[model samples]
Target: MDKNVLFQKFVAFTAAVHQTTNEITKNVKSETITPLHYKILEYIAVSQPVTLSEISECMHMSMPNTSRELRKLSEKQFLEKVADDEDRRKHIIRLSKKGEAMMNESFQRIESRFIERMEHVSEEELKEIERALDLLHSKVFN
Candidate 1:
C-alpha cells in the first residue's frame, strides 16, 4: 500500500472517531452545562487537586477564562477549591460528589453506546480492534 493512502485512511479513521465521540457526548450536555463545561469536569475528575493555572494550561485556556468557568462550576456545585497544604495562598481544585456522579453517568452512557455498536463485530474482529487501539494509543501518546 502507498504511504499516502495509508495516511489518508488513518486520517479518515480519526475523523470518524472524533465525530462519534462528539455525538456520544451530546447526551452529556444540558441547558446549564455546555460541552466545554463537561470537559472541565472530566479533566478535574481525572486530575483532581489540580491548580487553576495547571487546568488553564492543560485546557489551553486563559487564566481569566478558566477562572470564569471554574466559578460557574463552583456555583453549579460541581467542584470546589481547597487551600494547598504547602502553600496557603495557592488553591487546588477538585470535583464534588455531584461532579463525580455526573462523570460516572456520562462514562457509563458512552461505554454502553460503544458496546452496543461493537456487538455487531466478531470476537476476532474485536480482538484486532483492541490490539490496533493499543498500538495507536502507544504511538500517539508515547
Candidate 2:
C-alpha cells in the first residue's frame, strides 16, 4: 500500500473517532458536568486517592487549573479531598458516590451509542474491526 494513502486513511479514521467521541460526550454533559469535568471524573474514578499533582500530570494540566476544576467538582458533590496520612500538606482526592454514579451513567451512554451504531454491522466485520484495532493498539503502544 502507498504510504501517503495509508497516512490519509489513518488521519480520516482518527478524525471520525474524535468526532464521534465528542458527540457522545456532548450528549452526556450537564450544567455542572462539562466534557473536561467528565475527563477529570474518569481520571479520578480510575485512580482514587490520587494527589493533586498526580492528576495534574496525568491530565497534562497545570496545578492551578487542575485545582480549580477539582474544587468545582467538589462543590458539585462529585468528589472530595482528604488529608493524606503520609503527608500533611498534600491531599488525596477520591470520587464520591455521586461521582461514581455520574461516571457510570456517562460511560453507559457512550457504550450504548457505540453499540447502536455497530448494530447494523455484520459479526464478521465487527471481528475484523476488533482485530485491526488490536493490531493498531499493539503497534502504537508497544
TM-score of 1: 0.80
Query: Clashes in model 2: which pairs?
Result: none
Model 1 whole-model lDDT (C-alpha atoms)? 0.87
Q: Pick the candidate with the highest TM-score.
A: 1
The lowest-lDDT stretch of 10 consecutive residues in candidate 1 is 23-32
Candidate 1 lDDT over 1-142, as tens digits, reads 7989989998999899889988776676445787789888888887787999999998899999999999999999989899999999999999889888888888888788889889899999999999998998898645
Q: Clash number for every model?
A: 0, 0
Candidate lDDT scores, in order, read: 0.87, 0.87
Which ranges of candidate 2 are over 4 A from the true structure? 1-8, 46-51, 57-60, 82-92
Distance from true position, residue 51, model 2, in Å?
A: 4.3
**Model 2 lDDT on a 0 to 1 scale:** 0.87
Question: How would you encode candidate 2's per-residue C-alpha lDDT over 1-142 as one tens digit per residue?
Answer: 7999999998998899879878766667455677788888988987787999999999899999999999999999999999978789989899999998888887888788889889899999999999988998898535
Which 10 successive residues of model 2 have the least lDDT summed? 23-32
